[model samples]
Target chain A: MAYEKPLPQPTAIDAPYWEYLRQHELRLPRCQECGHIFFPPNKVYCPSCLSDRLEWVKLSGRGKVWSWVVFHQRYFSSFANDIPYVVAFIELEEGPRLMSTLVDCDQGEIRCDMPVEVVYDDITPEFTIPKFRPIR
Target chain B: MAQMTLYDFKDKVCFVGVGDTNYGALYRTKDPRRNQYTLGVEAFKAALDDAGLNKDEIDGLILVRIPSYQLFADMVGLRYLRAANTFRGEGRMSALAVQYAAMLICSGLCSTVAVVYGNDGRSVGATYGGEGEGSSPYDVLYGMTSPGAAVAHMWRRYMHEYGAREEHLAAVATSNRRHAGLNPKAVFRDPLTLETYLTSRYIAAPLRLYDYCLINDGAVALILTGAERARDLRKPPVYLTATATCTDLTFFYTVDDFFRDGVRRCAEAVFGASGLTHKDIQVCQIYDNFTPTVIFGLEGASFCKYGEGFQFVQNGRISLGGELPVNTSGGHTSESYMQGFGLHAENIRQLRGEAGDRQVPNCQVAMYICPAPICAAHIMTRR
Candidate 1:
């Protein structure tokens, strides 16, 4: 049976992140005062300096796979068909890491620190999900 | 490294007693006769009986994964408590509850404290994945929907970065199972072999069935009093040398660095206050919610280099007869998964020389580590 995985419910702290993912651009919040760039797209004060001034800076959409796991068991009914799919932790060029799935490649090809580029998956009508594909 | 102000204040308290019902096998599934409160009270009662004290003696109550503090207090016949609180979490809160009780004692707010923990996640069929409660939505949407999946990635990363293989993880599982066999109360005492571990089906590719923690119904209570008072108690006092909690909540699942900094922070404070190095620890009861977590914790506690944790476990270093034993009570994996409560209880037994077959002989200082999402640690030394 085919089913959709859970979707993100955009909160005020993270709405801009989903909005940019929908537009095929990856952006992260950077502290204007301390120059600290971070991920998960929801932040108020800088984690380093506690400054409230921040900006959503567009990323290069390139990163290295810090780590990855292949889901062999279906924790979610929606992901049953995708059993053995890979969830790769991507360390973007700008320092922050994001939890994303590997795409446009075979499962055996996933490796740590492998260079990857962001790819858009329009999994839902309202938004697009940003995943990574091994940079060929 | 900055220190939390409370770290200096923990030395006065000690864990004097640990008690639990026969979580042997009957309690793994829910029984109509018991709920969370009843189980909690049962453990609480056992602890009081073990401590040779009455319910009226406890002035502080810290409940982890239990509800109805008032009802429980009334049920346990504990009246006029100076402090009562309910804590909830994966496993971190169990050890954190110890600190909660200790801080209350340190501040002169309470004379004696009881840290009670009870869980029914298995029979209740609690999921570690999906939406709110314990999981992050980012993971719920992706296929990495469970704690096991998240930790599986951690092992994959650790292996890739440090030259570890499934064989190394097999060592961890094999050692714990061996230790569990000695523990009659352990939930799963069936012997596990490395060959079997390597062949076991994967729940999340890198994490085999052996790497996961069992979800079973159980409760563990720890009673704390002043170190001076504990020395004269029914059992040998396990002095609370130090404890610390750390969290890296900024980015995604398990946070920015797979929660390594939390473990590091906890280790610094725990070791610093004890005036003990990693070498002084005779036994280590890591919160083995998953096998890779032990790997992360070993690195955090300075037992080994960041990427060399796998190498350290090889050749029986983590086994009972080795230089340092890790999880001699089987931890959450093979032991009763009372959240992280069982790990602390096991270390206390080891320190008191009461751990029958699994005892690490000449055990003096034992370390309890809760490594992950939020890390907490305690150093308990025999007095």
Candidate 2:
């Protein structure tokens, strides 16, 4: 079936982030001057030092749940089937945090700071998104 | 570098008129004819009547929720505008509008300013989530849709950081409902209890149905003028003592600091300029778009130490007769969710000692705070 769920429309600033994800590699921009790693990959310059000299560094695909929530109400038709699904803010070991889904885990067992590792969800041939699973 | 301090505009401007559509009357009214501007006009006319001023006297206009100043100005025949602008229909703009209006008046741009807001949200089916509600395409990918979801995560982290239990969140909803019971205009006044709150379905887990605000149709308007001119108006003037705002432009529209740094800055500016501490505030109206927001607002405003807002609200602390009453008008959750517009109006009413049964006695000083990405706060006094 065609992908019915929402996909990130890559822009010029962050297109490489998605392109790398398509290859099952989790990389984010690290500022050369300030060494600040940031997520959503939308910035051309370092948010901390405003340095334009930054490079996409490979990540460990590991993080902890800084915070999380379960969706009991459906706001999007594409997400209706995933009612009660878990979405979380994963704070990567590299220090940047981003929102992604938590899969293959019991909702009742989820707790803040629980160790998690990234897993790829290739919903369509054109796109592959990173989700997380508890590091059991 | 020059040291920057807030230009003190305290007591220079005052709210002369406050008006709104009958919230209780329009709770579920689906009047297709009653659009945003029509509702705005209704509130505008009532504010003019309340101020005992003719619409022709409104030389300045600041609009919220409404799309354009030109559209509203054309409809209301306000052609003498020296200053006029419109804000995006975000709840945070309510206090900003008042602050901006005060600036205009103090700058001698216009003496009498009208800040108007109207929303046909309920009538138009405001989901407050999904594609068009201003979520990025990236956020949609993870099914992170509503504003409540972001707050839920924050609330959960608050729980982890502060050891606050579910009862703390329940207390906020129940107490607001308790206050709503005393408010004739409140929408959900039928005695909410801890049990009821606990059993409420989670719209976003960790933030239950009761945590979410009601989506309803309504409009709110307030008129402002020089404090000297306001004293001669139809009602007692509520002076704008001090106002401050801070912003966080994070990718998620939230911060791990839980908005404390920003809110604390706003608190210092508002209190420092007003010469009033939280103790001097007889009543408060913190923006409660979500119940957790109330917790964040209180902590950020220094009503309690950071991580203790959930505790500060316990044991009737935030009740109408509590040490520091908050959201005595039932706030956005039980009251009509006019975004921050209704809460701002409620604060003015409390300061005026005109809030009917929900009035805080001798409410000489009142404050309003919203601890969102754009954290804002203002202190008002009847004197």
Each prediction's TM-score versus the true structure: 0.93, 0.97
lDDT of 1 by residue, A29-120 (tens): 99999899987666698888999999999999999998888777767777777777788888999988878888888887778899999999
Scored against the true structure, residue B350 in model 2 reaches a CA lDDT of 89
lDDT of 1 by residue, B1-383 (tens): 66656446656888887898666664445577676787888888889888888788899998888877887788888778999988875577877788878888887899889999887776677767654445666666676667787677777877876688877888888888888898888888889987789889988888888899887778889999988777778887888888888876544544434566789898998887778888889999888888888878888878887888888888889999998899998877888788888888888889889899888887889998887777888888885
Best by TM-score: 2
DockQ of each: 0.68, 0.87
Candidate 1: clashing pairs of residues: none
Runs with alpha carbons beyond 4 Å of true place in candidate 1: A1-3, B1-11, B27-30, B131-134, B253-261
Q: What would the per-residue lDDT of candidate 2 be over residues B1-383, giving only the tens digit for each residue?
A: 56544545778899999889877788845676988899999999999998999998899999998998899999999887899999988888888898899889998999999999999888888998986777877778988878888889899999999999877888788889999899887777899988888888989888899999898888999999998899899999999888999997677865798887788899899999988887899888988889988889888888889998998888999988899888998988998898898988888888888889988888899888888888898988997
Worst 10 residues of 1 chain B by lDDT: B249-258
lDDT of 1 at B345: 86
